[model samples]
Structures are given as C-alpha cells and as structure tokens.
Target: MNVQSKYSILVFNRENELFLPLTEFYYYQQKRINESSALSYLITLERFFSWLAKSSNYQGTRVKWSDSHMAIRTAVENYLIYQMGCKLRSKENFQYVIMTKKSPQTINHFLAAIKSFYKTALHLKLYEFQNPLVDADYSISIGSFSPTSIRENKPRLPKIAGTEIPSDSSYRSQSDSYFKLVANDWKPNIIADHDLPYIIYRAGSEIGWSLRDEVVIRMLFETGARINEILELTLGDYRQRINQYEIATLNKGSEKRRIKFLRFSQDTLKLLMRYVNGERKTYAHEKQTFTKLSDSEVIFLTRRGDPYNYNAFYSQWSKIITQAKIKMNIHKTRHWFVTNMIRNIYDTASDGGEIEMKKNELINYMKWKDPETIKVYEHYFNEALFREIHENMAKKMQEYEKEYLKKSHSSSEGEQLSSSVLQTKAILPTEEIEWINEFYKGME
Candidate 1:
C-alpha cells in the first residue's frame, strides 16, 4: 500500500492539497448518503488513485487527480482487472504481485466507488467525456434463495455470478463472464445464546479487562448493531435515564440514514455507568497530561482518551477473544442478538396476523427497508425450531468442552482453566449485583 493511500481520500494530492473536484464529489455524495458511507467511497477512490500512481500505461509517471478522461478510464479498467487477479503487461507492474485477492463483494464496492466518482465528476462538469463505468460491468447477484450450511445450521449466501449483458462498444464487450471473480461465500456465524453470559463474564472480568472494551462487547451483543454504528456513539447520544443510545447509521444500498435506538440491559447499563464515571475519566486525564485536550464528546475512548477507531477497537476485541479462547468473530454476536430478539418478539403460539405484525415491528427496529433481508434468519422464526437448535447446540458445546479438556491435559504443563472459559453459565451473582447497586448509590 502507498503511504499516501493510508490518509483520508479527501486529500487529493501527495502534497496534502485539496482537489476541488473530489471535494465537490464528496459533498454531492453526502447529500445522498451518510457521512461514513460517503467517506468510504472516497477511501476506495484513494486506493484506486494510489494504484494508478504506480501502474504503467498511463501517459505520465505521476497521475494527478485531474488527469485526462482516457487516462483515468484506462486506469479504472486495469485496476479492476488487476483486482480480479490478472497480471498487468507493464514495465512498472513488476513492482507488485497478486498475493492478496479481493472478494467479489469488495471488488463490487471498488466498482461502485469508481463509478460514483466519475458520475459525480460528470455531473459537476469536471469530466467532459462519458463516465468510465458507463459500459458493461461486473455485479454480484445473490439469488433469491439461500442454502443452509449443514455444519453451522445457518444460511450461506450463494457465490456471485456474472450478470449476462448484451455486448456493446464499451468495456467488457466480449465474454464478460470470462473475467469472473469468486464472490464471498458468506456464512453468518451465530453464537449460541447459552454461551453469551460466559462471553460477557469474560469480557467484564477483573483481570486484564478494559471497562470500555467490556461495554462495547456487551452493547454489540445486546443491540445487534454493526461495529461502526456502535463506535459512532457519543455522550450526547446516550440517554442515561432511559437506558438508551440513539445512533444514525448508514443503511446499506440506500441514500437514507437509519436512526437506531440501542436499549441497554440493566447489567450493561451499570457497567457503562462505571466506565463513564471511573476509568474513562482517568484515561481522559492521562490524555490531557500529554497534550492539549479538546471537548470531544465521543463516548468510547482509548487508554490515551482518543475516540476508538475501527483498528484500535478490533485490536482490543482480538485481545478479548484471545483471552477468552473463542474461535468466533465480533460479528457473530450480532447474529446471536438478532436471532434471540426474533425469538423473543414473535411467539410461534400466537395468531398468524400477530406474527406478521411482530415481524414488521422487528423490521422497523432493524431499520431494514426490504423485508427479504430478514429471511436469512428464517430458521429461528419459531419457538420449536429455536428450542431444537438450542438443545443441539448445548450438546455440541459439551462435546467441545470435553475435547478441550482432553487437549489441555495432554499439554506440557497442566493449568487450571478459568470458569468463564470452561463454563457456560458464568453469570454475575446476587451479591455482585448488590455491590454494583451500592457502589453507584454512593456515587449518586
């Protein structure tokens, strides 16, 4: 990756100069999409621009943001080809290798960014020529029906297939399917609800636990929110009296922003209060000691009191899972939350119309415009199915525990395992709740 590429895409040049074209394009995007989504599009543009700087066949050694239409067009095509794992026939192309491959969904995102960039450029009269991506292009087609994974018992979305298009004078004219890239065979990992308490217990453990990290974990599990949405939370957005936090997250595939309210459980609320009043304040003071402080109202902060970025939060989560010895991603918690919420909100024993009403309510809560998206979790639609799956999961978890113990016994040195890792029901005790109540009472 180019050093300049790491910077925000809003920086149009290596000299940190702003290019009016991209600035105008970004503002145009902001009008239609959320700020984060707009910024992501710009970030994609940055990556493409960085690749153009090094790639051969462009007229100049240095490609400016305001390069000619043909140059930019050719670069866009070549970049897509390169991302699809084709070698570029250029002298300077030897500087790079196809070690890492991009998924179809990722390439589609790149395509979207480039297309949007040129579209905006044309709209703003920055580019007089036709849009580069006006020709036939690659798009991922996730079919109507998804197949269930026998191993995980969850839906695995089908791979991306090329959209059959009539040949024309523009790009991808000949056998566009020949340039097929494998799409993401995405399988939603669902964490069993029985194991959730143990995960939360480990997250909030006294040893090596960061209260901020714990709060974020608990919030994700409880709210079924995307990590970015949760990270966007601020002190101003939080309503302590209502035990809710409101966030305006970008809804996928649309121009609208979804306003979501994350209602916290009583335990999570207590932990959040403790973090805000105690550890976070210390972090803020430490940050002030090193540098001039600004009145940033962002809720979750690093030890240095800087607001949590994705990479920093991911690193913290990595540490959390490593200590907990779990083979699950942070995203699995969302699946768990969503499935459980569905189970709770819609009882199968209820009338048919009531089910539809509850489903509509869930769709509204999740801020989903399309009802079909909820079909992915269709397996957990009923109480009977949920119970069966839960029972099977409990058995599987026991077998996994036994296998884990057997491996531990065979290790060079036998160490006693933490109950938070080995046990499924490691919830907080009555006295601990009493202690939390008393502690907050004194603070009040």
Candidate 2:
C-alpha cells in the first residue's frame, strides 16, 4: 500500500487494492468546499478501509481484487454490526474486542465516504466487477437470477451532474435543552440571561486563564462565532466603526466572505485590547518554534506563542466548560445567541416590523445567505422560550394588579394598614381585568 499524506490525512492502497483515491480528490474538493469537511471525508474513507481489511480477515478469507461486490456488502454489514458495540474477533490482533458504535451522524458520514469512493471507482473503471454502491435503478451484475441479476440486466441509472450529504437532531437537541435549562441546577443560579456574565467570571477569575484563552472563551460565548473564524482573526482585524468596535472575519459558508460583528460588549473589547496592546506584544516577540507556522502570526496564540491547534483548543475549551459546570457543547453558545435573540423580541413585545428587522439584522450578522437555514435556531429551546414568556407574563399581571390596588393608597405598597383600601380594589375589579386574568390562568 502506497500511503501519502501532507497533514494527518491517510491516503493509501490496501494490499495493492486502490479501493479509494482520497488525496487528490480531497485536495480538489477542499478548493471548492471547506477544508475541514474535505479532511473529514478523507479520514472516514481511511477508517472504512481499515474496517474492510478487518472484516475480510474475520471471515477467514481475503478480499478478492476483481469481484468485490460481495466483499463491499459484507464489509459494510460487519462494520455496522461492529459499530453497534458487538464483540468481534479482530483479524489483525486475533483477539475478541468490543467495537464501539459511532453516533448516527458519524455513521452516515462514513457511508457517504464509501458511496463517493464507489461512484468514482465505477466512473474510472477501476475494477471489472460491478460497484455494489450503485443505485437500484442501475445494474452491475452479470448473468445470474437474483436481485443482483435484475440490476445487471436493467439499464444503468443516469448520473446526476452534482451531489453530496442529517442525523444530529437527538445529540444536538440534548445540549440545546441543557443551555436553556437555566440555574435550577446552578449553585449561583445562572439562568439564560445571566449565563454570559456567570461564565465570563468563572473563566477569567476562578480559572485565572491567560488573556488569549479568556478572549477565546469570550468570543465563543459572546459572539457565537465559529472557532475557525476566531482563529483567523488578527490584531489589525479589530476596527472601530463610529461608536462601536467591530471585528471582520470570514464567516462560515460556501462564499467564505468576511462579516463584521457589531454586538460585542465593551468589557470584551477592553480585554481584547489588553491582550493585543499588552501581553500579545511581549508574547509574539518571544515565539521561535515552527518558523513557517501560520499560527506564528495568528492573533490567538499558544503559551509558546504559536497559533492555536483546533483539537487542542477544543479539548481545552470543553474542559473549561465542564469545570465551570456548564453542561453542554461549546456550540450551545451559537444556539444561545439565536435562542435568546428570539426571546428578546418577545421580552419587549416587538411589532412585526421590529421583529422582522431584527431577523434581517441577524441574517447579515451571521452571514446567512439563505434566511431559511437560520430559522432552525428559532425552533431550538422552544419549550424554554414558552416557559420564560409565561413566567414574565404572570409577573407582569401581578404588577398590574398591585399598581391598580395602589391607587386606593398613598403608598406604592399595599401596606396602608386598612381593610378599606383592600376593599376598594376588591370592589372595583374591572370585568376586562378579570377576563384577562382568567385567560392567563388558562394559558398557565
């Protein structure tokens, strides 16, 4: 097997069989798509090949070079079984081992990688036998009486000009709900409204984190920006626009264009400036490792003053959130941003125009080309939104009643120490007010 890779990528032929070509394809696709996504496709294919080699060995047989139709099918079945935490005898180690099943999202991604490989293999005529991954509309079998035979005799399906890859629902919704769970479980009572400040204090004070690390935490929670976008920023990128400080970085999408953030807090701006004008100056000058590394120039630097590694940054971030008792993925920050923004519209009882205006602002703020995809955030934490609105409405009603009762007294409080004042409110409750209270009770 000839394995070649520049980064952590694994592109190799297995026992002289070129079941996939990922290097060139990955590179080609990276230019057209996100680099992270391209790398994931390559890694998934590598794992699939490993599974195929192991599966073949488990059955006491070697994979054939020519007729891999059965091999592909069997390999996939074994891989799926293995993913379900089944005990399987490894051909490589010759010992029974537990095969840990991946998430539904990961499994689907792996399937896509295999499907794409087969599609390419068939197009290039890499093998004489049929590609098992072909759609049911096509035939890849030769003279035989079976489902395979039917496809063989049937005409091949026309290839579409373009294509590509949902299952994160259960996994993600759990975290979304956790973020909206508020402080019933929190010792300090960190609800949705106060989560930002609560976390900021913990990250900066309890952890005593470095300016760079603290800034990263702030950027994640405050702006809900992607890690890549934050890592791509520089000292020069932070610009002043009138009274506000905005940072323009490339947003996540096909276009990958820069978008300006106009909603960062003044304290966050000060911390960022402190890091840039103070510590960053001393730190940036001390870095001497990996002279050609892009991290050397990137704004968020490691203790060694090099650029942040994605895995390292993520691992450390997850640790921080866990230590702080924030029970969710960092991506919840993005969800928090959208979810709270929606809640704010109702908090102020905004009109159609104001509500629609905020949505438009969000479209530009998040760099969303299609507003439709952004609507998904609206649905997240919907139950929590309902609870919050209900609670606030109930409070407002109580305040209205107190205010009405206060008219019968000289004080704001109902502490006139007289039954006549209380009788005044009791005797003059409006029919409309009674109806409204009744409606609220029904809503509750």
Query: Could you give me the TM-score of model 2 versus the true structure?
Result: 0.54
Tens-digit lDDT string for candidate 2 (220-256): 7678676677877754455424445577676653345
Q: Which residue runs of candidate 1 sit more than 4 Å off their true CA positions?
A: 1-35, 50-67, 78-82, 85-103, 119-130, 134-209, 227-260, 283-298, 301-336, 343-358, 379-444
Model 2: which residue pairs collide? 83-101, 139-151, 295-307
- Per-candidate TM equals 0.47, 0.54
Candidate 1's TM-score: 0.47
- Top model by lDDT, which number? 1
Clashes within 3 Å, all models in order = 0, 3
Q: After superposition, how far is residue 245 of candidate 1 from its true place, in Å?
A: 11
Assess the local accuracy of residue 229 in candidate 2 as a C-alpha lDDT between 0 and 100: 78
Clashing pairs in 1: none
Estimate every model's Cα lDDT from 0 to 1.
0.59, 0.55
Q: How does model 2 fare in lDDT?
A: 0.55
Instruction: Locate the minimum summed-lDDT window of 10 residues in model 2.
Output: 177-186
